[model samples]
Target: MAWQLHYTSARRGPTGRAGFQFVAETPGLPDGVRAGVTPYLSYRPPPDAPPSPDDSELGLFPVSLLYDRVDGRPLLLRCSYLGRDYSGRYGNFFAHAVVAEPDELEGVRPAELWHAPHWTHRPEPETPVLESLDELVPGAALDPEALAAWLSASGPGDPYALLGRLVDAVAGVLGRGHGRVVLVADDVELVARWIAVVSYSLPVAAAARLSFVTYTADPDGAAQRLVGTTPAIWASAQHHASHASAFDLRKGVRDGDASRFARTVAGCWRGPDLAGLDALGELAPLNDPAQEAAAALLALCRGDATVTAAEEGAAAELLSRRGPGIPEWVWRDLVPGVPSMGLDLALALHERARAAGAAEVARQCSLRVTEGVSDALAGASALAEIAAAAGVAGRAGVPVDPAEVSAAAARCARRGGGDLGAALAGCPGGSRDALLDGVVAGLAGARERERAAVLTPGNCDLLYAHAGRLRAVPVIACAVLASVGRRRPGHRIPVTGELLRLDGETGGEVDAALGEVWSEPPSAGECADLLDAHGDAMARRPALAELPSRTFTRLAFPGGDGLTEPAALRLAERVREVMPGGRAGRDAALVRAYGKAITAGPAGAARALADLADADGATPQLAGEAFVGAARRLCPRPPAFRAELLAALSPSARARLGARWTAELPGRARAGRAPLRGAEVGQRNELVEVVLRLRERGVTEPALEAWARAAATRWLAAKQLDVHLARSPRLRASLRDLLGDGPPSRGGR
Candidate 1:
């Protein structure tokens, strides 16, 4: 019964026209089978499934079995689909039918079964089962020529190397070494050993047969999952399973928990399991405790200073030493100051001063924050300046004597409202997780929902206008220097989440670096000084000009809200200066700062668009493309800004864009050359999108549209076209919808 094929080829619905059919066109088959069979459908349940109806108690299902002929006997392929696409609405999702040649087939499970066995003891569906590949490829023999061809074609690593090792290991175990074999287990470690043993030999294939069974992956497939490696490889690879586990937190280095796991399992990977590989399947991941600590520390550094390349490298260098995870006690102590004012931080400082006869620990934490900032003078202190509220400069912003600072602190002790000193008095220790959560939430909150202070007396008050979600200064100030900086040519440096071995000798250097990173004590004098400078800058700028964007740590709306063309361009320059060395971090910060900076007024934003249109930086992939999106999100009149920007292109850019692309199209196509790229390409694409958007608003300028169309035409007409744009059917539809362009009739990019 298990081996028998069950398929229904045709069925009709309430309307005769609503019919279904599946007719196999196989050759050399007997007429014993009937044609035009009834349809069979596996049911799919909605996401919010209700209780089964009475008729659904017995459920409806569909299945197709697979077989191969051997010695005139039908050998069951036992192929099954292991998963389903959960993309669309529930039901058969017939729109996405899955049927292909056996070799090309991926196993997918049937849709949801409405009924379950009344008995609770029934085996739950989709649990991994051990199976043998030998049964499918029995009495295996290899063609030496074919084997040689395959081996020569295969690379020495990854997919190819792993396959070779696995086959070799299996062949060795079968006593057919240097010959043929194939490769599974439930005991993870033991199974890993079994796989390792097979790696020493290789296998040969004679002929292949393919069949498929369908299985939909349940959302919780990991509930009782097992390794998909077959029984043969698992048995063979057992020889090479033992080695030191990679740095286990439980047992530490020499224990070899992960190394054993990898050599046993990963190193033994042969091919997809006979039961079918679940594309959606996931392996339970292991981690190195030290790497986790470094990641947390990286997040800490990004909190305050706009993380820069130098700072990032320094922090990475600190972590690469791998002396230790930031002790759990460190987090426990730091959490209090992170979300609230550093009351507990100060208390700890005082206590440590008494107990250790020094205040180095708290001093280190303070120093970490100060050293991260590359430009202390330029950094703003909104909290300090605003709280000080002195006309030209806030209280903290003035160059008062140290006596005046002490007097102010005493007054803060009494009033205790928004004052920094008052907030720090008796610092509270909040839950560690809560503090961590707040820090994370604050990370990307710099540019969020624009709560435009429309009703405010002064519309240009950028501070209150673009005021971001408030977080304690300490939360931003406290940082962790992740110092695992290693650079090898052609190797990309990882930003976070990596665990590499640290030379044991560097432990002292690691500690010293960590100490230096956090060594500076919090100085009220310095913070006040920063605020004073910021206030002075703010006071000099007219209140009616721009959003009050200057802050204690960094300038927000730099060059005032009515930013000049140079200042607008300098925004990208500022982004370039504060890049995180890594492209991803830099792009995110660039987009974020760009969005925040342009939100104040349309005057500066228009010029910013021009600068961004000609942007050059670390993230050429995003280029000026993202600035368009960021500006749109923050701009009050995006369409108008676009229109204004289109009216003025930099001379070089305008000439390059409106030149002979169309006239040279034929020759360019013959030569398979692209028309434009880099800044020009990005700017061109941006113009097209903006023009399309403007057209949507019942507006169209002939020159603007012509320019945009020509740019789009050149991009589409490029001889060596990008595959994504080339193959996209929706490209025409999108153009028609957005810009009302007809389909390209001939060769294209």
Candidate 2:
């Protein structure tokens, strides 16, 4: 697409008005005509006008440049109707042409097109550099001078892409009404070219509203020069600056210095400002896992960094890695969902984790910290929150400094005093128990005066109370004892049944601040006995549960005289121990079920019996005892219900206790009272009848036989026994002493 222009001839009319001629080589001209006027330009010299530079009677004309769409290069033409006369009807009107140097072109100013009257009176302004952008950029208007300057400095690469991004950014900044943007690039020349394109792309008036500055070396001078009233400023830099509002342009370019690069960007006043963070993510070295992980730290620093779903995934991946470059703020921000901690400790943890290559510990610690931090935040005490975070770290299998925990706990105690229970309650799950221990240790180490203030009788009671509800935490119980010793030097905590006792000032060397008191751990029997004597008192009063060394203690023990379903269940785990072996053990199981039956309901007793019978280490005899106890307690039940209960037990247990259970059934049915005449007599007969039916089904034993014979004798004398018993040969044989001489002799009645 070679583009050129030349003067072919000039003609003068008889009236002394000259007409010029020129030939153009513009390929693909409309209708295939290559010669015509371009730039829609025209000129008319005065009658006394001087000859042109070629001395052929032609003068200079100012015209805007045009770019070929195929390649971004400038083209010039001289004609009256270059594009308008594409049909060649006016081809003979072409004017002679002359090309001039840039300075020479600038020297001669042209009147504004179609506004010659205004320009004719006023001084003609310098030739406004313009370009026909319709062919190259559609509707865009290009500043020829600015485009020339930018193209010259843009070096090697696609500068147009950068131009598009800069234009969008400037448009956004303008819409925002105020903004501070810094464009980061490789060198000063590239930065300058980008700024030039962005500044001139907008309408001339709108472009004047924004200020542009490019800082290379001297920041102080640049800062001074930045003083202006412009609502928006777009700055560019080749290097990092701490105060810069930075946006990196090094997208998709892994430089291997990502860690250092990211750190510099992160240190900026507004962090990375979201402009090129995605690009920086690509800049991270893919070959080095450590460097990639390190690069992520800067992104994590921004609160709003997770701008996209991909970013969220990236954050998760980075967090899963073992990066040694973790900063202190990350740790501080992790706990309590807020940032407030010194760098030394967090830095130490980072170093330690880095050395051990245990990034998983950090990951787990962060998760656990978040899980428990909400409760601490609700507790409204920063110290308690810190302690809770430490506890969570411990739960996550991350080692935390004892001093840190102690200090946080001590501060919490000092601030909260008697409200320690409330504070502990605010912590969730394991963190609650963990924070409790720390509070005890921390308070114990305090001066006697300070300890006394926090461990006042009421406060100790409160702390002890909190300890009780906890599933397992011994230090809190010890702290209570310690506080008690301080108040009453030799007093022991009074536990029912004497299961646990702590003497003040024991001879054994111990932490005196913990009341210098100690007690031997109780045997399982003692703990069980204590729970039995207490009934639901432990459930009602948490301190009772906490007072015992075993944090797992609950109110229910099996052999209690008045057992409850809850008690039976609380001791369910230790059922075998409660009813060890032998007949005595069986009797104890019966007693437990009996107590539960009396207090609660038959259903509850049955459940308890089943649990006891099925417990590990339970003997067959004990199981039998439990079955009999549950069935006997359900006496006077319907026949079907009694059968169902018996069937629920193992075959051996049913066989062992069925007889004893049947023997008790008759008495239980009558409610242990003799039947009277009339309906009472009928009811008595029915009870014996049911027993007979049970015996017929092979459910009776020797005990049932003995009971049946005795019951028949008593019923006979009172006329409550059914005389028809003589009909059944089996009953007649068993009750012969009461049924009389014969089986009624059929017709003797």
**TM-scores for candidates 1 onward, in order:** 0.16, 0.27
Compose the digit string of candidate 2's lDDT tens values, residues 1-749: 22234332233322333443333222333332222333323332222223222323222211111111111222232232121122322322233222222222221111101111111121111321222112211111223343444454543443434443444445455555545455554333344344444433333333334444433222322321111111112232223433333344443122232233333232331221333333333333323333233334344444434333333334334544434444444434433421321222233333344455558545544444444444343343544456445544544455554444445565665554445655555554545555566567656555656656666676676565554432132334555655554454334333221223233332231233222332332333544454566534433333333333231122223223223344343444343353234332344454455456434443464455556555453344444444455545554555444444444444544454455454654453334344444555554454455455555555644444455454555534324354656466675453454335644222201
lDDT of 1 by residue, 1-749 (tens): 11112221123322333223222222333343222111222323322233332335213222222222333333322121112223322232221122222332122111111011111111112321212221122111122223334433433234333443343233232332122221122222222222222221111111111111121112112111111222333334435533111111111122122221222232223332211111001111112222222323333322433333443333333333332432333333433333322222223222333244334544443333223211221232321322222111111122222232233322322232132322222212221122122222333232222111111123112111122211222111111112211211111112011111123344343334323322331122322232233323322222200111211012213222222234433433433343233442344354444554356454455454444455544344343444434443442244345544434545443233223222222443223344654444444444455555555554555555565554445445422222323554444344455435555434444
Root mean square deviation (Cα) for candidate 1: 36.4
Error of 1 at 566 (Å): 65
- lDDT of every model, 2 decimals: 0.29, 0.39
Q: Return the lDDT, model 2, position 674.
A: 47
For model 2 the local lDDT of residue 744 reads 27
Native-to-model Cα distance after best TM-score fit, residue 322 in candidate 1, in Å? 19
Clashing pairs in 2: 36-82, 37-79, 37-81, 37-82, 482-514, 482-515, 556-567
Worst 10 residues of 2 by lDDT: 111-120
lDDT of 2: 0.39
Give per-candidate clash totals: 79, 7
